[model samples]
Target: MPPAQSALVVGAGAVGVSCALQLARRGVAVTLIDRGPVGGGTSHGNAGAILRAASPIADPGIVWKVPSMLMDPTGPLAIRWRYLPRLAPWLLRFIVESRPERHRANADAIWLLGDQAPDAWRRQVRGAPAETLLSPVGWLKVYSSEASYRAAEGGRALYRARGAALEEFDAHELRQLEPNLAPIFARGVLHADGLFALNPRRLVELCAEAAVAQGAVIRQAEVVDVEADDARAAVTLADGDRLEADRLVLAAGAWSRGLAEKLGAKVPLETERGYHLMFETPERSLNRPVVWEDKSFVLCPMEHGLRLTSQVELAGLEAPPDFRRVETLIPMARRMLPSLAGAPTDRWLGFRPSLPDARPVVGPSPRAGAALLAFGHQHYGLSLAARTGEVVADMALGVDPGFDPTPLSAARWA
Candidate 1:
């Protein structure tokens, strides 16, 4: 192995921080750089769901499946036509990936990344409490229409192949499982291995602080550019400070696409804008995270309060947020959780870095000096972030990753 080297990680969200911390632990003096505060990117205010198999969006069927959803105002996934011009290339790749063959391949890679992701998190924190770090409570899926209930078979099979448990329940059994649910619901599915964090932002912050405690330098600086020589790379901050290192890791979440472009690498990257509204405090709402298929939203009893989150908008990074998109969810959230009678004290929007294929962009960047690319994780950032870190560190140390890196390598889009 090469001598202990220095690495500069550009981006301090879950992926960047995790990679930085993991590398530091492996004897690589690490410095994490970010445009804003640590955990300020998409990592800070996600839906907080740590779903094992529920997050990847590589459905080869979704291309055909999205038309109706796009036309309907209340549909779960939406895209603004105005941004369609910019989103054309991304949408094209998305459509092509909708093919069954491509979707399965992508899904397989993501499942591998996600399945053991939790173990990496456990390894990262070293004895973090399960209660504070995890909520083993399984996920519940409630559907009002029989057709929608049956539609789950396709996804259920996919989960089973990926090793997630899918337990079916009749309307009667569903009512028994969730007595508080409205009688309007008919049938349900239990994602038996479901999990979500009690607080995602807190977890990122804790990881960053932990990394700092262990001698990793965490800095607040927006990376404007990166330069590479024959044998090393360096990141240039917005303020003109250039920090040099032997290796570079790019984990900049939604903002990572532009960096890829700057690096002269072509990656089919786009942002899947996600929104959330959290009430003042936990109203002591029902237990577990509920995916209300009928309502196209989820009401999670977060440590702070009920967080109603869901909706995918394909606007480019420069597009302004349609607060109404977040606002539109209020009524449906109330319908899902009857006890949630209060308006949210806070609202937010974050970018879930997405790829044309719905899997993460991982492994080394080939356009320049030694670089590991770990972005485009979309909704699975937190759930898969730590594992990605371990892999990045393993690559830097020239250690076997124990899994194939072909799917995640930056060479795919080339």
Candidate 2:
């Protein structure tokens, strides 16, 4: 296929904006459309850690652990009983993907993108204000139980073999690194090359601005429908406006399933509803983002406040926001960090686009020749955004992205 002269990218979150930026830099005329303001979705309200290495959500034992996780109120995973019927099919696939071999394959693919994330992110924000948004303080994961810490041996060994810059710390060392944190952790592992965003939402906006400077257009509009053929792709806006382009990129994140199905690819994409609580206590800041592994939440200190980000509810998009889920974890958060006092200043809920195998669909639409599909990063969306965008742009411009994108292809489901 010849390089596209014009492209229509649907979604303005991190992935979509990054796609627009990469395409525009390659001299393609790009139009990015989203219903909300830039970075106003999952990209806006994340824990903001760009990990040097990330594992797939489909760990080998996840299948047996789901039952107890659903029953536990303070557990990391939740499901609205009302939505369980609708979520059954997706859950079944997730269990199948949790087999040891499949999980390892997914982990390998995720690390392929994650390993290149830091460099791709720096390149994406070069000479832009967005560069200031990133922090090199690294990421810390602490374990309160020795059982949980020992359970991670396989993954830790894999990270070491992959050449990740890792350092292990005893409880004393962990307390020494973050003096404010309570000395309750049994062990800590730090990814020395990890990056954190001081303000994740602002970073997205700055990236959009950089894309605009590169001649990409960002429009505030809802894409109600999409279609494509061998020659061109098109979108119909909510207001009955229609637009056409030589190529189309579906980077709409959690809401991308309906649009992608319209283009002949039935991707098994589901939403992982995430919630966060923000406390405006800059005085109680940590040097780096800390993951309380046993509790399954991240306590990250950002520019705005200390954010307690957690939860993976199976509720669909139409379900009401369950602020109570995060609220219930507040006492646990306070236990982890005793300085937290009173109520949180703000709360947020967003949806993460997840695939059963934990690898994102980031290549050509199997049936729609002129359309490209890019979503389903699960928890690593922010971590893998720029690299996925680089791959998409390479596909658009008919250039090889220097790696086999076959592992992340949508055809795996077919």
Specify the highest-TM-score model's number: 2
Instruction: Show the colliding residue pairs in model 2.
Output: none
lDDT agreement with native, every candidate: 0.79, 0.89
Candidate 2 lDDT for residue 78: 90
What is the per-residue lDDT of model 1 for residues 170-214, given as tens digits with 9 covering 90 to 100? Answer: 888887777666667778888776566778888888888877776
The residue ranges of model 1 lying beyond 4 angstroms of the native Cα positions read 1-4, 54-58, 129-131, 281-284
Candidate 2 per-residue C-alpha lDDT over 44-123 given as tens digits, one digit per residue, 9 for 90 to 100: 99999887656878888777788898788889899888988989999899988888888778888887688888779888
**TM-scores for the candidates:** 0.94, 0.97
Which pairs, if any, clash in model 1? 60-98
Residue 111's lDDT within candidate 2 is 78
Task: Please tell me which predicted candidate would have the highest lDDT against the true structure.
Answer: 2
Measured on C-alpha atoms, candidate 2 has an lDDT of: 0.89
